[model samples]
Target: MITIVPVETKKQRAAFIDFPHDLYANDPNYVPELFLGQEDLLNPNKHPFYKHSSAQPFLAYKDGELVGRVAAIYNTNHNAFNKVNEGQFGFFDCINDQEVADKLLQTAEEWVKAKGANNIVGPINLTTNDTCGLLVEGFERPPMAMMPYNFPYYLDLISHAGFAKKVDLRAYLVNKAGANQRSVLLLDKLEARLERSGIKLRQINLKDFKSEAEKIKKVYNKAWDKNLGFVPMTDEEFYYVAKDLKMIVDPKYCIVAEKDNEVIGFALGIPNINEILINIKRGRLLPTGIFKLLFGKKNIRSIRVLMLGVLDNYRKLGIEACLYGRIIKNAMPSGILEAECSWMLDHNYLMNHAIEQINADLYKRYRLYEKAI
Candidate 1:
């Protein structure tokens, strides 16, 4: 008999987090997530999301053998920000069995219903700000930094369980050989023109990262305010995230737009550390995994332009192109051969256009699914 078990004890929760290691043991494209990072996210006492919402991790068992896992989330912040009574399922992993998938989804559905959610949505590991979405395309290569990956059968499994597409997110690839450098070539002239209007584009000041991060947080909260399911992160949340990213953030790949010393726009490209994480056995950074992460930095050959945004008033000013251009230009000489400008809203025309104009290929697609309960 198949049964769904609530993850309660520390051992059970560790099993829940480590289940993917076993499920994808043979999949070459599967990159293990850092165990400590995953643990921190699932730990409410450590993650700030728990300050307002709650979640539960579950495991599926078939005759005593673990078969699948999922997390049912009651994101009070998401509901309040979106004005919807919906719940989310995340950190989902399972075998090819439709029955197991059904049981897992049902478990989440029931858990969320108890919390008053009328509809369900996700694959969002935590929030939209974090790694979320089901990979529906571009399976030829391993995922870029912070992106999710899954088997093709996952689509069928979720669909068979009644989930339908809510929206599609896109990933674009830019290679040094095929990238359009017109933006980079004209960056000087563009900055000159913007300077006439009191705007300047420059690299982030790592020496004053704390203050710079605070300014960028304001620009970030405002720039993406109209995006789907976006919420203004609290001060603690932003600082917490900033502290983590600071460790790997490269000033060359981090840029900002300033108007009379006020940050109005910013873009950050983090090195694709998956190159090293893939070799970290089961994502555990111990015994030797920590050495790989620390010593393998320079061997990384790609970057993920994970974030790029400009204030509403700064739109259409060619600032976006310049930001993209600068990152591309900076990467060419740094031994980084490629970068992915990703997780774009499919309908975000202006931003999508900026990417396309620079000749970024839409290489991958990830989907979010929803079903009314």
Candidate 2:
């Protein structure tokens, strides 16, 4: 018999967090999320997301053995912003059993239904602002930092369970050795042209990070406001994330486009720390694991250009090329072998074309699924 259990106690929560570690043990490309980080994300008191939204995690068991897990999420901010009644399912994992997958999704669906959601959409862990989407393509390599991964069977499982593709997200790969240097070569001229219009490019200032982040936050929200399912981050939420990224951020790859000292655009590229975390057993940062993370920084050879945005009015100003070019130029000297510009909406042609201009290959694809109740 299959039993669906709400993760109420600490032990149940731990099991919910650790289930994927066991499920993916035999998969070489599986990368375990950090235990503490996962814990905080699910914790209402620790994560700012819970301040305005609520999510309940459920675990599925077959004959008393854990087989699947999912989280039912109702984001008040999302509904209020998008003007829709939609719930999300995220942090999903399961074995190859169809029955287990069905039960896990059903539990999430029912929970959100009780919260008055008429439509369900996801694999959206918390929100679009966080790690969201299911890997539908590119199963050959392990995922980069803050990206999601899943087994091939998940596609069939979700489809059989009545979910259909809502949208596809794209990830592009640019290797230093093969990347076209047109962006780098034309970077100076582009910036010079932008300068004539009072816009200039520069790296982020680590010393004034607090003020800088606040300014960039405005640009981030404005630049991405029109994106599908996009919700502006609250002050606490932005700082909560910014504080964490601060530890791994390199000033060289974090550049901004400014006009009279006002940040109109910015790009942030973080080290692919998954290189080190993949080796840390069960994502535990303890004993030997912490040492691996502390000492592994110098060995990392790649980055994820996770955020690159320009204000709507600033579009078509060659700001995008300048930002990307600056990152590529800076990365060359740092021995960064490759970079992944990721999670772009499949339909974003303008931005996609900009990345393609630098010879980035579309290597991976992820999807979001939705079903109307």
In terms of lDDT, which candidate is strongest?
2
lDDT of 2 by residue, 1-373 (tens): 9999999988988999999999999999999999999999999989999999999999998998999999999999989998999999999999999999999999999999999999999999989988999999999999999999999999999999999999999999999988998779988998999999999999999999999999999999899987888999999999999999999999999999999889999999999999999999999998799999999998999999999999988999889989999999999989899999987999999999999999999999999999997
Shift in Å, residue 302, candidate 1: 0.2
For model 1 the TM-score comes to 0.99
Q: What is the C-alpha lDDT profile of model 1 across 127-201, one tens digit per residue?
A: 888899999999999998899999999999999999999999999999998998787798889889989999998
On the 0 to 100 scale, the lDDT of residue 368 in model 1 is 95
RMSD vs true structure, all candidates: 0.8, 0.7
| TM-score for each predicted model, relative to the true structure | 0.99, 0.99
Pairs of residues clashing in candidate 2: none
